[model samples]
Target: MLLAVTRQHEVAANWDAASLLADGSVSPEAGCRELPGCWGLAQPGPGPGDRGPCYAVPAAVGPQLPDGCKAPRLVCQLHFTSWPDFGVPFTPIGMLKFLKKVRTLNPAHAGPIVVHCSAGVGRTGTFIVIDAMMDMVHAEQKVDVFDFVSRIRNQRPQMVQTDMQYTFIYQALLEYYLYGDTELDVSSLEKHLQALHGPTAHFDKIGLEEEFRKLTNVRIMKENMRTGNLPANMKKARVIQIIPYDFNRVILSMKRGQEYTDYINASFIDGYRQKDYFIATQGPLAHTVEDFWRMVWEWKCHTIVMLTEVQEREQDKCYQYWPTEGSVTHGEITIEIKSDTLSEAISIRDFLVTFNQPLARPEEQTRVVRQFHFHGWPEIGIPAEGKGMIDLIAAVQKQQQQTGNHPITVHCSAGAGRTGTFIALSNILERVKAEGLLDVFQAVKSLRLQRPHMVQTL
Candidate 1:
């Protein structure tokens, strides 16, 4: 959302000045009353490092007013997490959609929009220019970005700082002229859900279908699978058809000059609140099983969701990577089952995973890992009921409440169909719970940008 202000806390926290911010969050009960001169946000049920772009934080700001009243100011803080520092957003559409919601909250008549980034210039100016550019488009069907930028610099030097930042102003404006906002509100959720599930498109394209087309067609950046296609790494893929793009592919920690060992058929997919929220991968092949556990250890993920059985419908869907009863060692990693609980819909297993340190190293490392296996859906077709998936996601969320929202490892047969669908649902549910907004088309499109053919079932 800026030219230099990249991360969340670097821009602003709890709608306060960026300079006075740190990387800590407050519970709802412990408000700004504890910190005299600082801003505090009542976290709305998100684990640490889990809050995404466009999260609504209930904040309490301390006052140094002349009136001498020591009351705290209640504020609604909107944070956008994906905008790269000194660069434009990957999806200009997401920025425009955020702008729409911002206008809703900060009406012109109410007061001036309070905008600030780290340096008080680049990102701040870009947002102000975009707001003005869109207003000009609406009123006169014309925009003079150069003229506006020149004017803004007169007021404050270096408003739109970088060449990419200047170019991005036009990109966002032109995107509005090309593809209008396609995000869905919570109020109209039923209509789109019906369009997705029902046989209603007789002649005209369904609304959801049109939205999906827009999402796939207009990717602003060129995407390619560079490292995954190398001759050395091709053997690791479970399904040749699906591979992650080079941009968001999860890279393994390189040992001292280790070659090609870092490649895995996994992409870091974004959840509603954070990037790399899910490490989506293919079902572990016999040779690739060790790489899968290595990914969990490297990424420090505590939760794994397996969407298919070891063999489904007489076909080898996944290899049995874990032991049925006791501990199993793969490479240096030893996984022991601490407990197993199964319901009609899901099987929850807790494993005590230990990595034997090298003889030179001082201490052994151990972690508690939880795997949620759900095989209720049919292998060939859709599920009999949607509630099972919703509840299954709820159970995963319950575990995330304990794990503090590290990147979750999700695998299906090809890590494309059911894996993608589950991630999209997880993202949508999280966004809806926090912001009351849904854009199924945008959600799936974001996934496909990271990896190929996510949400393949839909």
Candidate 2:
């Protein structure tokens, strides 16, 4: 429970104030460490004015503890410089963003955390109320704001100092729940189980049983028949003809003087914020590799998520279209490996892709495309465990966020099973964060409308 920073002088004078934790000067006193330098302070920007930055503080530098009292060796302080003590933040979204940063810095652990503000009440109380209610919301699906605040006030008399601050707590909780800052109390055992297996077999299994009861549902299967602008000659170019239906598949519009038809076995998938957040496609075959690069350039995609490797279990899953060292020309698209790193479960390659425009004077246009190659997932089945998959997805998401939200290209062997599941999980978790609960059945159902056989299992 930390309040937002107020006046600069208050930070200088009040050692325990939130402002001091952020931009305070160093103390020359015996145990007290010097400011700035002592904290190893660095501003994580978007910061002209205090959006807040995190720093490390050595516990030994602070005042001595009572004899035999255990003390933490290192203290990490996440300071908010945004709001003034007199008022709430200009926007709740900014506070939510800062709180998310704090959580990222300090994940859950089995211990009571120390929270304080200058007065130990105002903003401090607001933060505690919001966090407690947020936790309650995650554990259970709802929260009683009035009851929770009353309880906190009983423990710490006048806990929330002002009515505005009290209102802010409610606002923050709502913003976090509805705008994507969800935290769940998933046990380590459940996570382990989920990582190894897909989802628990508790949901939608009955519906799936009923759906599979019929040999084929004509209503559901009809949506896959509408392939727009798909020429008959280019139909055979698709890796898996039956899985990718026409309606939901991504249609690449042809450019002037293009040698081949603008066709690729890819479809758009929705994300939390964007309708076409990702383009789910099959791993490129030897002939379609050039088309893949063309799609990447045309879409201005910054990230390419490769779920299947070039070869898996002696089968050719994807073509090695990317160059190992130098540049490789695929039709009018030339991709050069600027840098690459291969880890155990995933490989990240930074490619400098140049698109040649014959009609233009410059002719060549370049952009950086990052390719995340997931090496462990099997071509025909899910991963043996999900931790690596989760990590890989998280890394890709972090990059996407930093690089500006663009339509990412995700692909596997046929891009129907593994590819669809990956997209579904990403969207489902986002929906949970944004809307509190998830509807996996609706998520997969909507996806199947866009691309058939998505989420291949219940």
Best by TM-score: 1
Which candidate should be chosen as best, given lDDT against the real structure? Answer: 1
Task: Give one digit per residue, the lDDT tens place, for model 2 in 1-458.
Answer: 22232333343433443332222221222112224664342222231322221222212223346789776243444555555434576346446655665565564762455665555566677777777787898899898888987888888876777777778887777656643532333334355435435432555444345433321331345444545224652443444443455645666667679743566778887665566888988888887787788888888899999888788789888888799999999988889999999877899999998877767556348888899998877656678998887788788889998888989999887777778888878876664554354544445555666676765654
Name model 2 segments beyond 4 Å from true: 1-240, 243-247, 255-260, 358-364
Q: In candidate 1, how many clashes are counted?
A: 2
lDDT against the true structure, per candidate, is 0.74, 0.64
- Name the lDDT of candidate 1: 0.74
The residue pairs in collision within model 1 are: 3-86, 52-273
Q: Over the full model, what C-alpha lDDT does candidate 2 score relative to the true structure? A: 0.64
Q: For each candidate, give its TM-score against the true structure.
A: 0.80, 0.52
